[model samples]
Target: MKARRQRLILEIIRQQVIETQEELAEALRAAGFPVTQATVSRDIRELGLVKVPGEGNIFRYAAPGETPPLRRDERLKRLLRSSVQFMDFSENLVVVKTLPGEAQGVASAIDQASWPEVIGTVAGDDTILVIVKPKKLVTTVLQRLNELARG
Candidate 1:
């Protein structure tokens, strides 16, 4: 029931600008989920939601923004930087090691960067295995990741 309500609330927020818990509560009720304000509050926290620009003093929630971390670009600047301990590539796979717990965020930043060489990335606690297209892209991928770490 909780997951159902939360999904409905998230869908509502994603589709429209939802302000206050009161508004969310009403939306939930409309969606046939009897939800309390406290439930909505907890859901917001659990979802890692943030309020972005909206109408008037009413704040709207959204999944955390993907606009790269502050003070740098998405790849080397945002995620790698000092946190990246090592990086290397073999064939079409690039391995990146970060200071534990940072790999996921760094990898997420890379995924959000929308690079052409990147087919996709698999991230662990402090490591990421980035898969590139056409094995030859290894050098280019490594160079791009290295540039990102520059920040």
Candidate 2:
């Protein structure tokens, strides 16, 4: 029952914006789950749901690790353009330098972009190490990053 409720919650959020626990509980009840606010809150925490910027000033719940491609691309471009100070690559690794305290945010944007060639990233303070798969693809990834940074 818990699993099914959680699944429904995920489905509900994916279908429409859910901005508050009360809204989620109401939706659950409408779906026949009959959940309490506490239950909804617990389910939110257990599901690791995050609140993301919605239309204008509103924010709505979204599943962790789930980002629409267009939004992700725009976010990555904005972060790269504003924060990235330098970028270079060697072999299968691309090094990105950002303003102080910006590396993790930049790395997260890169990760969210979900580029096929990128294996992963490690960030520290003002630097990010982006690991690419296939040595030949490193330059391609670097070029893409440069383009994003330029935007």
Candidate 3:
């Protein structure tokens, strides 16, 4: 039952811009799950749901690693433009320098972009280490990052 309800929650968020726990609980009830607020909260946490920017100033819940592709790209572009001070690469490793307290957010945006070339990223207070596979692709990744930073 829990699994089924959580699945429904994922589906609901995908289909609609759910903005609050109360809204989620209502949707669950509409779907016949009859959940309490606490249950809804726990399910959100267990599902690793995140709030991504929505239209205008609104934000809505999204499943882990599931920000829509266009929005994800826009977010990455925005982050790179605003927070990144410089980027450099060597071999298969790309280092991104961001303003203090911005590295983690910038890295998260990069990870969320889901670029095939990126293997993983590690972030500190003002730097991100982005690892790319197939050292030959480092240039391609760097080019893409530069474009995003410029935009």
Candidate 4:
């Protein structure tokens, strides 16, 4: 039921520059979902939806990837939470350690992150090799991954 609602809300936003919970609710209603503002609010949160600045101080409920960075952040958080056991960096590479059989999934997510520093990834049973650029950024990358592990 929740998935269906989420899909419909996503579709509604895809059709127009949705501006408010009320507008979204009305849209969903017209499309036959019979929803309320509160439900739409919850759906928005669950879907990781956010408002992006539109023309003249207005904001729109943008689906991820209609904008920059937001979707990557969402996917990275989800992936880090699920699969990364540990991560470290050396020179121009990051080594992500995962639970046995999980490295490939996490590696895939990191590749999808589209982080400018990340060049590519290679995965084994419990490890990922993240090729990075600008070797000077190694410590920064390590610290970031450690933070991800901690949280």
lDDT of candidates 1 onward, in order: 0.76, 0.91, 0.91, 0.78
Candidate 1 error regions (>4 Å)? 1-76
lDDT per residue for candidate 3 within 90-111, as digits (tens), equals 9899999999999999999999
Error of 1 at 140 (Å): 0.7
TM-score of 4: 0.54
Which 10-residue span in candidate 1 carries the lowest summed lDDT? 66-75
lDDT of 1 by residue, 1-151 (tens): 8787777777888787776778888888888888788888899888877876554445577678723222235234745776899998888899999998898888777777677778888998988999998888799889877765673
**Stretches of model 2 off by over 4 angstroms after superposition:** 1-66
* 3 versus 4: better TM-score goes to: 3
Clashes by residue pair, model 1:
75-148, 76-148, 76-149, 77-148
Q: What's the CA RMSD for each of the models? A: 9.1, 6.3, 6.9, 11.2
lDDT of 2 by residue, 11-48 (tens): 99999888999999999999899888999999999999
lDDT for model 4, please.
0.78
TM-scores, one per candidate? 0.51, 0.58, 0.58, 0.54
Error of 4 at 86 (Å): 2.5
